[model samples]
Every structure is written in structure tokens, then in C-alpha cells.
Target: MPVELVALIGLLVVFATTTLLDVNMGAVAFVAAFVVGSLVAGVPVERVISDGFPAELFLTLVGVTYLFAIARDNGTITWLTSAGVRLVRGRLVLVPWVMFVVTGLLAMAGAPLVAVIAVLAPVALEFARRYDINPLLMGLMVVNGGAAGGLAPSSVLGSLSNAVVERNGLSIDPGLLFAGSAVFNVLLGAVGFVLFGGSRLAGVRTSAREPAVVRTSGPGATTAPAVAGSRLNGHRLATLAGLVVLAVGALAFEVNIGVLAMTVAVALSIASPAAGRRAVPQVAWPTVLLVCGTLTYVELLQSLGTLEYLGRGVAAVGVPIVAALIICGIGALGSAFASTIGMLGALIPLAVPLLGDSTLSATALITALAISSLVVDASPLSSTGALVVANSPESQRDRVFRQLLAWGFSLIVVAPVTTCLVFVLPGA
Candidate 1:
């Protein structure tokens, strides 16, 4: 077979392989690209390897994830969640929207995965109890809201995407970024409200009991031994202060976020020896490995001309139809996998070539990506999904997962359908 045809086959294989397996799409992309580069495309293996790492993308994910972890240790996220819950009592219909704003803002501040969960889970549980609503219903609201938070101006993914685009010589406007994301956020929020919130409003409630043994064990469990680090004090203050400074500087001063985040880790480590030791164990290593592996996959895909093929194919077909479908597909897949940064990192670059001539700019693509991120947030397989289920008593897990799964798929369906009609139709 000819090199171009072989490369094309490889690209299709990668898409199918990743969709069925839990493997990183980036890794699939990298391997496919590398094979094509060597035997098919005739590009040098060394060049493929060099580009495979995508240092910027890796740094962006690692920095954001780590910074959020540190922030979680400081109890800042708990305070934020508590504040939001306090403000929106007894307003069943509006809970999703409120959750959206709070989580989105916290994500912007570089709050970590479990930090987002740890803080929001309790508040959601409390809210469900107080309002006599289903715990799972409320949990979905918080997870979806937190997932939607990735759309905010200062979110980890938003910042990373903006930097990548700008670094590639494309100018980006923050206003456009925020506006497009805001629209996407509102659309996804409504989906959650209807699927999850509407049920609660109609008087569906869960009978989940508080666990008889309240010992911490799983994901959001505060299971670690009650040591000096358990108490929030000077150590908390310094760690949080360092995180704020680093996060603010990265966004405000345009400093490298990864470096700033590492600096915070180092400073915090030195500030309180015991706390530093504890934080090391607390960081989510699986997520970190996933990020790195995914980056490798993305770079490989680019090298293999897989994305170029897709982009050119779309261009050949006419931008309107292809672009709309691509955007929606990206959203659904990203939501399904529950990693906005990973999906966006993998998708956006391939998309840039396709989108250059389309009506949607990088900002618009970012918006669509943000919508996909939110969709994933609401999915039952997401880390947030587990977080929500774990927050309730053992019995409510199955029921809650089912309800949220229904809502998640509904949003995935409604969001793209609506976009095709509203956002894409106008532009396309």
C-alpha cells in the first residue's frame, strides 16, 4: 500500500482503538504517527520523538493538577464550596447554576481534582439533606458544575489552550474566550438542571444514610491519621498563600505556570516538613501518568499526519458540516472520558488546521471544548462521578449513578444538537 493510504488506515485504527479502551488517545496517536512517519510518511523517527513529548502541553497539565492539589491541602476549596452552599439554600432549580459559578471560579484558581471533589461533595451532601433532595441528584449538580468550571477565563485548560495558540503565532482575545465558554457553560448547566435538577424539583429524594462507621477510606475520605497536619494552621496559611501567589502570577504576570506551581510545591515543602511529606502521598499520581501518556499520544498523532488528514478531509468536504460534527464529537468523547485537558490537548492541534478557514476561531473551538469538558464531568465514569457516589451512603450509589448517567447522556445529546442548530448553524 502507498504511504498516504497506510497512514490513513493507521489514523482510523487509532480512533477506534482509543474509543474502546481506557488507553490514552495521545498514546494511540503517537504510535500511529510514528509508524507512518518512519515507514509511510518517510519523516525521521528522531523528529517524531522530539515532537512527541509536547512539553508545553505536559507542563500545562502537570502544573495545573499539582497546584490544585496543593490548594486542596489548604482547605481553600472547602471554604469556597461552603460559601456557595450557604448562599443558595432551598433554591432547587438554581442549585446547578450556583454550583457552576463556584466550581468554575475555583478551577480558575487552580484547585486540584480531589480538592474540587472534597470541597463540593460535602456541601452537596449537606444541601441534599437540607432540601430533602436526592443525594445523587445534588452530587451530579456539583460535579457538572465543577466540570463546567473548566470554561472560566483562568481555568487550567483555557490558559493552556490560549498559550498554545498564542505560542503558535495566533492571537487570542480573552473576552472572546470568556464569552464563548460562558455560552457553552450555560447550555451544559441547563442540561444538568433538566436531567438532574428537574427530578429533584419534582420531589425525588434519596434515602441514603450516614455511614455507621465514619472512618475515611476512599477517594474523598479524610482517612489519613489525625496528625499535626490535620489541623489547619500556619502550615495551611503558607501553603495556600504560596498557591495563590503562584496561580496569580502565572495568569497575571504571564509566568510559566508549571514553573510557578513547582516553586509553590518546593516552598510549601520547605515551610512545613510534615505537611510536605503528607502532600506527596495525597497527589493523584494516576492522573499525572495519564496526562504524560496522553501528551505522548497527541504528539505522535500530529507527526503521523493523522490530524492533518482529518483536517484536510474536513476541508475537502466543506467546513460547515465537518466542523460542526467534529466540535460535537469532541465534546461527547471528552465528556465520556472525563478529562477536558487531555481531550482538548489532543483535539485542538489537529483541529487548528481544519478550523483555520472555518467560521469558528480558536476561541470558538475552546468554547466547544469547554462544553465537552462539562459533558464529561456529568458522566458516570468520571472521577467526579465516583466522588458523588462515595459521598452518599452505600445504598444510594447505584441509584444515583443511574440518574446522573441519564442526565449526562442527555446533556451530551442536547448540547451538540443545540449547537448544531444555534451556534454552528449561524456560523456554518
Candidate 2:
């Protein structure tokens, strides 16, 4: 069999094993990457490690989680959660939208989507557990908001896509793309709100009542405050300062988030060794493993020509509209397990030839494709979704993972079709 075929089959096996058995998908992906990269694709082990391992992403996950873990350990998260609840007057339904808007603003301000999600998800999930809100609803809101914001002209996603289109000599409306993404995500968020019982939470008052006391029972127990009204102390103030610095440095200075976050975390640890010691182990290692491993396998697939082969085959179809749909589907599916920006880079250009020959609107088709590719960031395999699953209460992590997986896969079908109908068909 061809190396692409072998790599593709290896990917399926990894998914099946991870889903069916009690196994870490990252471990499975590492093995698959090695086998596919070395044995099937004739690449060396050093090349595989150098090329496939996502060191930047791994560091980002570790640094962000570590910083947040310290914040959680020192009560900053509780302070923020309480402040947020009070701001909304204990209206549970509004909390998700608050998170959504906050994340969106961060993304629009040029913060990386994964960084925003990592920083916010733990706090959001804590709020969900404290107030009996659905964790999935809260998590999805954060992811959606981040994604919506990521379409801004200054955002990483938006800038890259705009540059790609412009370089390819295709004209695109940045404002329309941003608006379309934001509106679509808002609509999806509204649907999620209703489906997850956002209405039932209306008028539900928790602020007037005594706040629940979160406690850690034993080893491996998740830590939370027994009461939400804890007054901010020196440690929390310092941690909050560190977080602000992180955000400013990342967004304004364009410093590497992973390196900057790690530096800040180390500083906080040195300042308060006890809290730092407690927070070290709280970093989301499994999530890091899962995300890096999945991406590694995806890198192997790309190196083996599987992704481009499939994309080209689909884009070669004579029917421009049908080819557009196929490209959207490929973007959605590829992006669920890989990088969204990477998918945009690979798939959008594949349609260049079709765009040159066909009557389809470049703006609409590219916008639809961009939306289709990114709308699935809620998938557990994606960085945002993984952070959500990782941050859930221990008892709820598996359930959240399953729910996110289902939601992510569903978007693979629904997003592309909807985008086609709304953007592509109207123009066609």
C-alpha cells in the first residue's frame, strides 16, 4: 500500500483505540507517528521528532496551566469567579455569555485563541460546578467566543488567512469575514444556551444565598474554596498582576506566550514556594499529551502527502459548488484533529484554480471555508476543547470529553453544510 494509505489507516486505528479502550490517545498517536513516519514514509526518527513534535504547543499548555494552577491554588480563581457571579447578580444564564464576550475581546485584541481558552476554561468550569450550570455549556461558550474573536483583522487566524488570500491574488472583505464569523458563532452560542438549559437558569439566584464551600478531600482532589467570598490577599493580587503582565506581553509586545508564561510562573513560584509546589502537579499534562500527540500524527499525515492528496482530489471535481463543499468538509475534518490555521493554509490555496475558472464569489467561498474550518474548535482534540476537558472537575472530565467529542464531530458535518448554504449558495 502507498505510504499515504498506510498513514491514513494508522490514524483510524489511533482513533478507534483511543475511543474504544482505556488508553491515552497521545500515547497511541506517538506510536502511530513513529510507525507511519519511520516505517511507512521512510523518514528518520530524528526528523520525526524534530518535525512532528509540537514543542511550542506543549510549552504553551504547560506554562498556561501552570500559571493558572498557581492562581487556583492561591485563590485568584475563586476571587475572579465570585466577582463574575456578583457582576451578573448570580444569574447563571449570563455567566456563559460573559465568558464568551471576554474571550472574544481577548481574541480580537490579538491574544492567541488557545492562550485565552487555557487561561479561562478552568475558571469557567469551576463556575459551572459551583452554580450547577452545565460544564459543556460554559466550555462551549468560551471556545465559541475565542473563535469568533480570532476572526478579527489583528488576530492570528485573520491575519494569516487575509495574507494568504491577498498573496494568491484573491480579493476578500476582512470586515465581512469577521462579521460573518462573529454572527455565526453568536447564533451557535444561542442554540447551545437553549439546548443546555440556559433558560431554566434565568432568575435562578445564588448570590443572595450562602456561597458553597469548595474543599479538597484527598490526594488528587480538585481544590476550590469553601466559600466564594474570600477577600483578595497579597498572593492573589500578585498572581493577578502576573496574569495581566502575561496578557500585555503576549498581545502588545508579541512575546512568545509559552516562554513568557513560563517565566511568570517561575517568578510566582519563587515568590511563594509553597503555593508553587502545590501548583506544579496541577498542570494539565494529559491534555498536553493528547493535543501534541494528535498533532504529531497529523504532521506525519501531512508529510506523507495524505492531506494534500485528499484535498487536491476533492478540489479537482468539475462542479465548482460541489468542489467548494468538499473543500469545506475537508477543512472541517482536518481542523478538528489538527491546526485550524494549517488547514486554512493548505486547503484555501487548493481552491485557487477553481476560483480562477468558476463564477463563485471569492469572498463568500473563502469566508464559508474559513468558518467551516474554525467552527469545530470545540472538538476535544483542538486546543480550546482540550483545555475545557482538562479543566473540568475530575468526576466530570470523561463525560465532558465525550460530549465535546460528539459536538466536535457533529460540527464537521453541520458547519460545512450550513456555510455552503448560507455563504456559497447565496453567491452561486
Candidate 3:
């Protein structure tokens, strides 16, 4: 049996064990990585730890969760949620759209997609809890909105996609790519809104009367209402300042978000030891474990050449259009588990041969491929989906994870076929 096939089977088993036995997927992934890397791949343990484990992503998850925990503990999240509610005039349905637009604009302004997600998801989930809205709906809105905006002409994904196409000697309209991605995402977001109880939430409004003072139990806990005259005190103010610093540092300065976030979190901890003590334990450790473990196993698969093996198989298909659709499917499936950028870099080049046939429109094919690759970032295993899961209320995190997994897997099938039909067929 091919080693890649065995690794692939192991990956499925990890998911199945997690689903059927309610085991921590991350823990299972870690074990899988160790076993596969050691026995089958002949990779040393030291190399596995150094190469497979994603320390940067780990830091990002830890830092963001630490900061968010402090915000939740200090009433900053409550204040922000209440303020958002007031801004929407207590219209619950509009809140999700507001998040969508806000994240979209940030992405359009050239913010990295993950940075935008890190900045907004915690707040968005908090808003969902406060308003009795569906967290899945809100999380998906934020993710889709980020993707939509991330395809803007000036955004990182847009610039990179355009550069790749141009470098390959294919002419593409940047505007068309942006418009296609944005419209697809917006339409998808609307679908999520209606399918996930958006219409039911619209008529619901917060009471005019102030509710009793309630405290959050812990991370992912239900939040309490803010006091009538609640205001940011010194600690909350400092925490907010830290968040601003994180944003500016990440977006403008292009600093590594994980390191910068950790630096800010550490500073905040030093400033208020008591608050820090309370907040440290609230970091989403389970989520951290899950993300790190899954990604590590994915890295193992990459190291073992599973991805390349799969890519070669797709490229070997005979028909150009059939090959194109297969390429799109690979992109969708690969991007769901790995980095979308990495998948784009790998798969787009594979499609170059098909494009060279001169029977397909480079613009349409590339556009379809790009959107197909990107739209699956909502999968639970992807960074955006993991962030959403990490920030969800604990009681609902499992449900949210399952929902995202189902959604992501569905996209792996639907997105590629639909995009192929829409973008590739007409041109062919």
C-alpha cells in the first residue's frame, strides 16, 4: 500500500474517532502525527516537534484567547456588545450584517484575513450570545465577509492571485475576481442568515428595561448584562489600548500577530496581576489543543508527500475540463485542511497545463479556482473556522465545530462543481 494512502486513511480515522467517540480531535491528531511521522515516514521525534507543530499559530491562538478572556472578565466585551446593540438600535437581525460589513471593509482595506478574523470573531460571538442570536450564523457571516473583502484589488489575497496569474502569462481582470468573490460570499452569507435563524432573530429586540447584573462563568460562558452606567475603568481602558496596539501592529506594521498579541497580553498581565491571574486560565486551551493537533497532523501529511501525491493524481486526468474541475475539488479539499494561500500556490500552477490548451479562459478558470479554494475557509479545521470555534461560548463550541465541519465538507463538493459550471463551462 502507498504510504500516502495509509496516511490518508489515518486522517479519516482521526476524524471518525473524534466524531463517534467524542474524543479531542487535536489529541488524536497529535498521536497520529507522532506515529505516522516516526514509523512510516522515518521522521525523527525532534524533527516532528520542530517542523510539524505550528508554534506561530499556537501563539496566535493563545494570545488572542488570553486577551479576549481578559476582555470578557473585565466587562469590556459586555460594553462592546451593548454599544453594538445600541448602534443597531436594538435590531438583532442587523447585527450579523454589521459584523459582515465591518470585517469585509477591514479586509478590503488590505488587512490579512486571519488578522481580521482574530480581531472580530470574539466580539461577534459575544454579540451573538448577548442578543440570543446564533453563533454559527454570526461566525459564518464574519468569515464570509472577511473572504469577500479579502478579494479586493488592494487586499493580500487579491494582489497575490493577480500576481500569480500575471506571472504565468495569463491576463486576468482584478476587478472581476474581486466582484466574483465578493458577490458569491455575500449571497452565501445571506443564505446562512436565513438558514440559521436570521429571520426569526430580526423581530427580536432587547428589552427597554435594564437586566440584573450577571457575571460570565468562564471562557465561552454566557455573558451578563452591563450595568446601566457601566464604563471602562483603568484596567478595561488599558486592555482596550492593548487590543488597539495588537491591531495596528499586525495590520500596519506587518508584525507577526502571535508574537505581538502575546507581547500585549504579557504587558497587560504585568499591569494587573490579579486580572491576569483570572484571565490566564480562561484561554481556550481545548481549542488550542484541537487546532495545534490537527495542523500538526496535516504538516505530517505534507512532509510525507500526501498532498503532492494527490495533486499528481489530479493532473494525470485526461480531459482538460474534467481536470480543471478536479483541480478545483483538490483546492477546496486541501484548503479546508491546510492554508488557502499554500493550496492556491500549489493548485493554480497545476491548472496551468489545462489553461495552456487555449480552450479555457484563464480569467474565468482562475477566478473559479480562487473562489473555490477560498470559500472553504469556513471549515472547522481551517484557521478562520478554528478561530470562530475558539471564541464560541463553551457550551456551544462542540455544536459549532460540528456545524462548521459539515459546512466545510459540503463546500468541498459544492463549491468546486458550482464554480466549474459557472466559470469554466461558459468559457470552454
lDDT of each: 0.55, 0.84, 0.85
Order of candidate numbers by lDDT, starting with the best: 3, 2, 1
The positional error of residue 139 in candidate 2, measured at the CA in angstroms, is: 1.3
Poorest 10 consecutive residues of model 3 by lDDT?
Answer: 207-216
lDDT of 2 by residue, 1-428 (tens): 77888889999999899889969889999988988788878899889989989898788778877887777666677677888888998777789999999999989988878777866787898788777889999999999999888888989899999999988889989999999999999999998998887888887877633353444433367555644556666887898899889878876677788898899999999998877787777777777888789888888888888887787687558988899999999999989878899899988888789888888999899999999999899998877788888777667777888899999999999999999899988777
Candidate 2 overall lDDT versus native: 0.84
In model 2, residue pairs whose N, Cα or C atoms come closer than 3 Å (at least 3 residues apart or on different chains), thus clashing, are: 213-226, 214-225, 214-226
Model 3 over residues 208-309: C-alpha lDDT tens digits? 233333545454454545334466678778888888998898887778888887888889889977667877767888989998999999988987888888
TM-score of 1: 0.56
> Largest lDDT belongs to which candidate?
3
Residue pairs with clashing backbones, model 1: 26-297, 26-298, 27-297, 29-301, 30-300, 68-111, 68-112, 104-149, 335-376
Best by TM-score: 3
| Candidate 1 per-residue C-alpha lDDT over 1-428 given as tens digits, one digit per residue, 9 for 90 to 100 | 64545755665687578668856544666666667677766778787678655465345434444444444445543343444544554345556556666766676665654356544564565556445556765676566566555555576656776776666656657666656656665665565567554544643332222222222223455653332222446655676577568645654555665577667777776775544554554444443443344445444544454444554454455656456566566556454543556556656565566567666655555555556555556655454554564444334545665576566666676666665555455555
Off by over 4 Å in 3: 207-228
TM-score of every model versus the real structure: 0.56, 0.93, 0.95
